[model samples]
Target: MIIRILFLFTYLLFSAQLFAQVIRYNTVDFSGMAPFWQVESSLIKDTEPDPDEWNALFDAPPYQILMAGGFSQKEFEQQLRLAFMPSMGSLLRKELDKNNPKSNFLRHVMQIMGNEKKLKELQANLQKAQLIKTALSMAKELLPDSFLYARALPPVSFIICDKAISHAPTGVIIDLLFSMDFEAYVPYFIAHEAYHFYRAKIKVPNLPGHNQPEYPIIQMLTQMETEGIADQIDKKKFFLNRGPFAGYEWARSYQHYLAKSPQAILQLDEYFIRMATVPNSDSKIIEDLLPMNGHPTGYYMANAIIEKMGKRTLIQQTANPFAFIRLYQRVALKDKKHYPPFSSITMQYLRKLEQKYYLPKKAEQPKQKSSPKLMWYEKDKVINNW
Candidate 1:
């Protein structure tokens, strides 16, 4: 028994050291959630709340990090206050506020409070150090083998909170209450959100300012590439494993959108053509047409690259969106029937933009007058579409 216990202790110590090298969970941020939830529950139940505990949550690392990272204080406070008085119509100040009792915010609060047993269960499960290690292990497995080689994955903290919306801006802020809905699939989300921080590390070349017409295209390109590659990290693995989420509604919907990725790509091609041919075209219409912030569409592109050129090529192109576009163009041409290739005009415009932006800033270039013999499309105005 003594030998077995020593072996187990040694094993756990080594495992923890290994996990720490890859990813670090912010235990300080996670530790605050349970206390906040308790105080929130007391307030919801009309019981006397601990003022000190309530105040402490606001000062906690999770709350402070979000506020420091530009998350609106009003919005953060509102999310917390909703649990205290969800039905008070006067409290709903924002036009975007979904005050319906069945709204996601209220619904999550209802779920969290209505099932004390489940909430406690989830809190215990989510706080486990093993869960982070396992989730990150799954994440590394899902990502392209050379994905991490392109750039260092940005440091990110995992924050647990009551807000239904989960996002990775500076840190990955997860909703403890809303996450209960995912149940066993929460690890999948953890992997997905963590990939975004990795995606953000890929630097964009110096490009047009926001006021320039090219700015919107740059935005669209970055959005698609970032979310597109990251989506595969989770969505592909989720389907492959299926686990308990095989018949889940959210899972079904996610797959449903993924199936429409082909159509989404064709739609984006049409938008790019307009931007290439027409002057001053922005990405708003394309944004409206794309599903789930260009995840499915971008996934289609990334998957196509992997299928035709191989994952290593796709991984190599991950750091450069311009290179990613060129690679996608190559793949689309190889299988024209399935993936519609971007037009020559669009390709030309993209190549020119890439060259102009990526040129060394220190090397001065002499601007020349447009040659009289140059074709209309070859001219600066047509190329820039400004």
Candidate 2:
């Protein structure tokens, strides 16, 4: 009995050590400055505390107060387990459902745990899995070659928090959020946002006579257009590596199937499409349209635009982000296709303007002369011409 007790105690000690090691951030070293794991202690406190220090998991009262001061390693780990594990499990189950003949269950199991040890092993194995590396590599290639920095905003994820989803500006921040077991839908979400950041850096031409109040609506439309471009790039890369019917489209179709059968798997495509075109509609329109967490239509419209742009190179010369909006408008007008609810009225207005201004006119030359000449008798020439 004494020997058995000793063995059990040793086992417990080993397990605790392993868990502690797993909780430590191992991706990037930040040892001397401050432990990356110590969220609150490292935060700059003042009249307004640093948002990065804020604990997303402490959704309740006293725990929220505890989080405000910052949490210990043990407390943070507990919060992570409580807040993330179940959601991660759900995501894992969904991924499993889409498993192909080549899918490895053990590999996905390790991803779910996401421990430092497991991550190292996964990285090593990914190096060996040439096919997956190629696929992911292709996806990376489609992204714009620029990094974006938003001054001091805390990293956020697309997870449903208090009935809303938020995104951060940087990919590194996004990767960290994903590490915390946030549900990842489309891989392009990070890449798409990054494109927006890139667009912001360059001077884009403004819409003539466009009102400032309409900026939000136009900005969302621009995001939709860029997202559509990225989607096409992703699709092409995915198809080239994995073959048609193997990549994002397959995942998208599978998601659609799940959404239809299980109301819980809500799709955001319709929501974003509406948001891009209709900013002033009653708030209840969204609630009525997608009773579940007001489906993010912005994200959806981005996806739709990507689908339309196909696999062409991204146009860097265009001044406006939604330069394609004009093209889409022209196509829709010419074809007489149904415009999305948000765009319907806008399109109608554009059509009227196009008819008013876009008309044919014959060019005429000056009656005096085609070439410059010093006319000594300009009075006589003018009188004769008149």
Candidate 3:
């Protein structure tokens, strides 16, 4: 018995060390922004940047991700140009022949960059924050079992950009201008996005058929599971003042949407009923019911699972959205007064969809000392088709 206890202790220690070694954080990719920042700090703030000076940015890993997602080189260039030379806004409008919403927003970003005082302050804050290191530590603490859920932990590349978004090919995009606004909560935001990046690596099933109603239904279920689980990592912290920037705009938006989730869930139930009954109904019709890409509704269901079933159960079933929905139904049915349960028909339809499309492989005992590494070449292939 003593020997067995010792062996267990040794195994746990070894596993912890291996987990630490596997997940890596990188900011070398963000060095691509150095030249652009240099140009911005120059007195030629109003002058259009020479295309060559900032052109290399489009080839950066994060921008390469944008291209893989179907953005064109011309569109990428125009976006960077808008940020780099906000003073040329008039000329940009004339060239484009109409107002571009993204360009309009970047023009405002340029106004801040054009101000030397604000620009220096922003740069100084970012340098002082040690964001990458802090975020890495936070991610480890927030989701210690990330490796168990994901096949491998790819190097998380932190890129400075004008907007925040999830599951970039390499990692998460951080909006440089708004980094300070997040302040002490940067780690939380980064950790949230890191969950998304890791979760994105999980593979789902193939489509049922070409232009089939099942396609949209599968897409909706996938989004709900994806955003729901990721939101579990960070959204609650925002609500509870777990960070310095509590009640910030983004947090407030999440809070607002979450409050509306009950209604949304009810509406979603109705949609699911239609999906189950109306054979020829366009599954795309349900798109209108999902606000904020189904984050709030998904988050609500995830919270239910965490409350009734357990976080471990949710994490263990991370690869299966069908499992996620069923778990939520179990919780909701138990508390029918407070939680609206899915109709039997809707539940049956969902199960039918799952069985038809999702083919789960048999569970195997995890190999000891298994260290799966997702290399850049493999990552690039994933992004190319992403």
Per-candidate TM equals 0.69, 0.38, 0.68
Highest TM-score: give the candidate number.
1
What value does the lDDT take at residue 23 in candidate 2?
26
Q: How many residue pairs clash in each candidate?
A: 0, 7, 0
Q: Which 10-residue span in candidate 3 carries the lowest summed lDDT?
A: 1-10
In candidate 1, position 333 carries an lDDT of 89
Which prediction has more favorable lDDT, 1 or 2?
1
Q: lDDT (CA) for every model shown?
A: 0.59, 0.34, 0.61
Residue pairs with backbone overlap in model 1: none
Better of 1 and 3 by lDDT: 3
Candidate 3's residue-wise lDDT over 187-282, tens digit each? 666666666656656666565664776777778778888788777767676553454434456556667888887788788888888867778877
- Report the C-alpha lDDT of model 2 over 1-386, residue by residue, as the tens digit: 00001001111112223222322311221121122223322221212223443433333222222233342435444333332345445654554566542123223223333364543443344234332223233344544333223221122222111111223222112222232332222233334434444445544433323454444444444454554444443433332235333344434543353234213112223444444467554333433432212122322333333345532333532224334545444433454433332255444543443333332244696597466663878868877898
Alpha-carbon RMSD to native, per candidate? 13.7, 15.6, 17.0
Q: Whose TM-score is higher: candidate 2's or candidate 3's?
A: 3
Q: Which of candidates 1 and 2 is the stronger one according to TM-score?
A: 1
Report the poorest 10 consecutive residues by lDDT, candidate 2: 1-10
- In angstroms, the error of model 1 at 353 is 1.5
Compared with the true structure, model 3 gives a TM-score of 0.68
